[model samples]
Target: MAEPSLKRLQYFIALAEHGKFQLAADAVNISQPALSAELKRLEDFVGKPLFHRSPVTKLTAAGEALLPYAKSAVGAAHRFNEYAAAVNTGAPTSISIGTVATFLHRGLPQTITDFSAAHPDILVTTEEATSAAQSDMLLGHDIDIACGHMPLQHPGVICTPAARESFWLCAPTGSPITTIAEAVDSPFVIFRKSASPIYHDTVVGICRTHGFEPQIHHRTASWSAAVEMVAHGLGVSLVPSPVARNYHGDERLIFTRIGTRPNAPQAWITVRREDQSTLIGDLALGLVIASEALADPVAD
Candidate 1:
């Protein structure tokens, strides 16, 4: 057996995760033919079939066996490279992050804490902003990175996906709803559009996908407020997995998977294209790791 290059292992992992040659190729920024060839080479190296190719792909037993090891290798390689970058460059005295309210509530704080530990001398600051304001702030160089929900357009800004967040259903306990469609007639609560338009649009869009427009009766100023309103029987809400995971101390609130399962939404970090450097990559990597930590599916 021959050791496969890290690129091939990465391609294997992406194909396994994304479940389609084209989609996985797009995710890893390679052509579909190239991805297919690389995956075939990887299988040849391992001397076993990995994926059962179809419209929707599934991992063969060999692929399942390799998945965890592949992920561990990739993570270790990333950390090594980050460490090398840190050693080769001048460490800045301060770095700042701007993010939407939801992430600030959940993932961003932990990322900041961990990154701060890694470089104890650096001053870290965070601000909560709407998705659009985040982009503007990045362009103005007011913040090193802008973290928010996607469709982050600005030719001068580069958007890197942080993590994919599944939306979970939040409803008051004892409500008759077990599925999102069951709560279609119930009032829906969302973050106010002005404060967090991405969240507001995501909730409305999810309801529309399940065969009706949401009767959005309440718009709260914060992510917690939306969950609080749902807990009080004011309405039901569809929130990202992080918010669902963190704010469940209230026994009146129920957090579970959306029965219809809207496509997972992506959170991204945008930087001014001109500001490419090792420090930005470090910031983005820490955030990606933290946000992905929050991406696990909520238990039923």
Candidate 2:
């Protein structure tokens, strides 16, 4: 009989990890019947049953014995791929990044441009993700780096402060709002908590400090959308100073500096702690530091 293939071992590892045939199949991007058939072939090759088909899938004795070997094989294959990628100049090295939408408009574009110039052979891919989702993406290996607000508390993730800026009050151009406290009676357009919990809570907390809960008239998924809603006179909003700067020339909106507060939100770049030494991870860190140096913080 032919030896079991590496693909079969990968399928076995996925099935062992997930413990559900359908889920395992989905994880490996194959159909259920196909996965089942491949597992049967693997069993035949090994001359033992690997799993018991029950309400909860249970690995057979042989399956338990094979688990460690399968995991090692898959891990070795991944490391081999990474090694090949590192040495192969002909193939473009890929780095996947997750970042907030506001960063794309503010300073990230220039940062990407500068990085591209220095490492022309590197391929960069970006996904606009929320601060909450960026941590999960980094942990899952879906993204190599994340750029967003601080306070990522995952064990395997490390966050480095990239920049700091105060929140500004965004209101309609003709509004009489000179201070955040003055907007207490006005309806507010706030960012959805699910997108950036830190920013959302900061806005809410700042409002409460000024003596009232903001009357939220709209909740938007992105900072730009919240600002646009404020521009149309729908409501006022509290936005990061950098995001407000992006609308500096717009006639429909005005940005007001909030008085000195104890807790100003700091932007951060996050990566899997293990990846900090990798080429892509190091480059990402350098790029963020360079971009932050060029940004002028809002005057106190």
Q: Which candidate should be chosen as best, given lDDT against the real structure?
A: 2
Question: In candidate 1, which residue pairs clash?
Answer: none
Residues 108-199, candidate 1: write the lDDT tens digits: 88788888888786778888887777765565455778888765676666777766567888889998887887887988888788776666
Per-model clash counts, in order, read 0, 0
Error of 1 at 263 (Å): 3.7
Q: Which stretches of candidate 2 lie over 4 Å from their true place?
A: 1-89, 261-264, 294-300
Q: For model 2, what is the error of residue 23's alpha carbon versus the real structure, in angstroms, after optimal superposition?
A: 7.9
Model 2: how far is 70 from its true place, Å? Answer: 12
Candidate 1 yields a Cα-based lDDT of 0.76
Cα lDDT for residue 122, model 1? 74
Model 1 clashing-pair count: 0
Task: List candidate 1 stretches off by more than 4 Å.
Answer: 1-92, 298-300
